[model samples]
Target: MSTELLTYLFVGVTFTLYIGIAIWSRAGSTSEYYVAGKGIHPIANGMATGADWMSAASFISMAGIISFVGRDGAVYLMGWTGGYVLLAMCLAPYLRKFGKFTVPDFVGERYYSQIARVVAVICVIFISFTYVAGQMRGVGIVFSRYLEVDIVSGVLIGMGIVFFYAVLGGMKGITYTQVAQYCVMIFAFMVPAIYISMLITGNPIPQLGFGSEVTGTGMSVLEKLDGLSAELGFAQYTDGSKSTIDVFFITMALMVGTAGLPHVIVRFFTTPTVRDARKSAGFALLFIAILYTTAPAVASFARINLLNTVSEASYKELPKWFSNWENSGLIAWVDKNEDGKIQYTAGKSFAGKPSFTDERGESGERLINNAPTEGVNELYVDRDIMVLANPEIAGLPGWVIALIAAGGLAAALSTAAGLLLVISTSVSHDLLKQNLAPNISDKQELLAARIAAGAAIVIAGLFGIYPPGFVAQVVAFAFGLAAASFFPAILMGIFYKRMNREGAVSGMIAGLAFTFAYIVYFKFVNPADNNPEHWWFGVSPEGIGTLGMIINFSVSFVICHLTAPPPQHIQDLVEEIRVPSSNNAAAPVEGGQTANA
Candidate 1:
């Protein structure tokens, strides 16, 4: 079959499976909708968690970022994986024991204040929307290039699919649907990686192939990539350009942010018991490792394929995938020296994003009005397109390319469903039912949840059509927000019995405001000043969340000490959650382990 037909087949089959799961597993009550009735098996929930955590950022854009940034990209791998460990070890079992439907539920009850719930709700919505924007835009990117549709249409289609399943099944449907998605995502991601690895290095294992020598060449893949990079005025593949402090900060921010992400945290609530939650966390780490370990290899392979194909190649003679991406507007060329060749040197191709005219140049290249920057580089390839285009770049089979399309969509949509569900819960359960209309029925609350989900979908669709930055970058900002706002509050509420509502609320507000303002100023208000030179204390916008988190902890700690302690009952509850009882010999212990005390 043609690649197009195969793409339609794979994507159609997967979509059908997702919708089928949603229909079959549709929630019948508020408990089911919010936490899948807390009946999911640990292993199944673990798979779902992997699917939820590995959004477009992990599945589609992570390797791409690594391919381009060289050494700097390791921060994502370290931060995200480490953060999950923190979440599972430090928070998951305790939160599951709390038995709340949402993070706001835990916050409100723990703090003994409705106002605190509202603040948590606000933070959840803000962080979720920001993260979902990346997932939706990733959906658009896949559909735009693979299905040959505009980004707006792609996003609308994605929103419709998500709306159907997410509204109907809620957490129950999303959880099962995500199980299938995890299978498809991991398989699709690995197939291409394995194929390229074997083709390039004669090794079947991607992780091993990353270090193996190139087929019939004396040098290793990394050596070849490093030499090629040096020849083109770029840094070695093993070398990173970011400062040590910046890397540390970004990693720290991502780690804590991951720990505090509402969507990921909610997965723990679905497990039947605290023990199950801890078991699922272990399962999820095993599943997540499959992709995370292979990402670096995929990055090196893609960079090698890309450089080998386009370095100083004639525009007309370039592969069809090059033109395909060009037509999709993800790749732009200007032939700066009138050489009619595509150059791959470092530095920006222009002062800003390409402002393409409707006209074609002499070599049939799309004309860009953007002024050329001081660089010999003549190509502008979107990093988001790197992984999606990798299979095509290496001339893999049509089915492999089509599978990539399906996998990319699966990754984006799974996380989108998870994020939207939390957003819906925030509005319907936290705001309308808890705060606004305390007398509402369960049925009424369910209806409100569905409506809130629909509205959130439309808003997320708009963000998808008009993303603020690259998938990874936007997600980083979301992580930073979560780290700054929720991490400190939850950590204190669990660990510090004296923490009051006033302190928790104040810390969240301050952390969120500081992080959001910094990101906005650097990412939106002054894109020109987003570099290290203009950063405060040499922390880039991406790493600013770590500092924000510190500010939150400090503020919360001081205010918590100054304010009156929480109610004695609340303090007793906190102690109960952390301390294991003798009757329960295998009770869930602190840091996600079991012990008889």
Candidate 2:
């Protein structure tokens, strides 16, 4: 079958499976809607959490970024995975022991203030909405390429599917769906990697292949990559350019943000016990590592393949994949220097470039670029297209390409659903039922949650259609906001017995305001001011969250010292959460009821 037909078949089958799972797991009550009735198995919840945590940036863009930046990209791998260890050790079990349906619920009750709860809700909504926009954009990129639709239409289709499942089943539906999504995405990611590895190094495992000698060249993969990079004026694959302090702060920001993200934190709430929550976090990290480890290998292989295939090749002699991506506007070649040969090199100038025009004669011929210039650098490649285009570039089978399409959609949709759920619950449960409408019926709350989820989907779709920045950039900002606002508050709530509502609320507002102001000023107000000279203490906007987090901790501590301490009962509650043995294995239901396991 053709690639298009194969893609349709694979994508259609996966969508059907998701819809089937959603229908089967529809939530009946607010408990199920919020936390899957607190009955999900540790292993299952772990897999679901893995799926929820690995967004489109993880699936589609991570390898691409790593391919271009080499060792400098290790921060993402370390930062994201390290955060899980923090979650497992410092946050998950304690939060699980608290037996709350939402993060805001824990914060509100712990601080004993409606203002604190509202602040937590605002943070969750901001973080979740910012992150969900990227997922929707990932969905659109997949659909637009494989299904041959515009990005807006693709986003609408994704919104429709997610709304059907997420609104109907809530967390219950999302958990089961995410488990399936994890399997599909992992398989899709690994298959091409293994194939490419075997083709180049005679090894099936990509990690091993990366270190093995190339089959014909007999040079180690790293050595060959380094040589090619030097010849092409690119950075060596094993060397890094970022300053040590920047790397440290960026990694720390991502780690803290990962632990603080409300969607991921709420996953632990679905587990039966504090012990299970810890165990589930381990399983989630293990599953995430499978892809995380493979990503670097994929990056190495793609870099090698791309350089070998494109370097010094004439425009007319370029492979079909070149033209395919060129038509999609991902790859552009200007034929600078007027030599028909395409030059792939770093620091190629764009001065005196000519306008592109079709030069086909009556014979109906076509060329990628009709413009010619004196510049040596002639091509522009977008990094975001690397992974999706890798299989095609390597001449993989149509079915394999189709599988990738399904996997990308799965990765995007699964995370989008999880974030939308967070947004929905924050509005319906935390803002309305808990604070504003304490007497609201469970049925009314459930209805409100569904309505909120639908609205979130629409808003998320709009953001996808008109994104303010790149996928990875927006995601990093979301993490920064989470790190600054939520991580400190939650960490202090569980660990500091004397932490009062005044301190916690002030810390959250201060952190959120500081981080948001820095990101907006650098990213939107003055893009030119984002350089090192303008940055505070040489920390970039992405790493500014680390500073913001410190500010939050310091401010909160000073405020706590100046104000009254938490009440004795509240201090006892903090002790209760800290001592996991005091709580029951199963989460308590409404009205302080516990169901039998």
Question: How well does model 1 score by local distance difference test?
Answer: 0.90
- Give the per-residue lDDT of model 2 (tens digit) for 1-597: 999999999999999999999999999999999999988998999899999999998998788888888998888888888988898788988888878889999889889888999999999988998898888888888887788786789999999999999999899999999999999999999999999999889999999998899889979998989999999888898899888888898899989999999999999989877778888988998999999989998988898889998889887777777766655445667755667777888864342222354542121112334434444666777677778888988899999999999999999999999999999999999999988899999999999999999999999999898876757667878888899999999999989999999999999999989998998999889988988888998888888889889988999999988999987878877776676564455443324444222
Q: 427-447 in candidate 1: lDDT tens per residue?
A: 999999989999999999999
At residue 432, what lDDT does model 1 achieve? 92
TM-scores for candidates 1 onward, in order: 0.95, 0.94
CA lDDT, candidate 1, residue 191: 98
User: Candidate 1 at residue 239, lDDT?
Assistant: 93
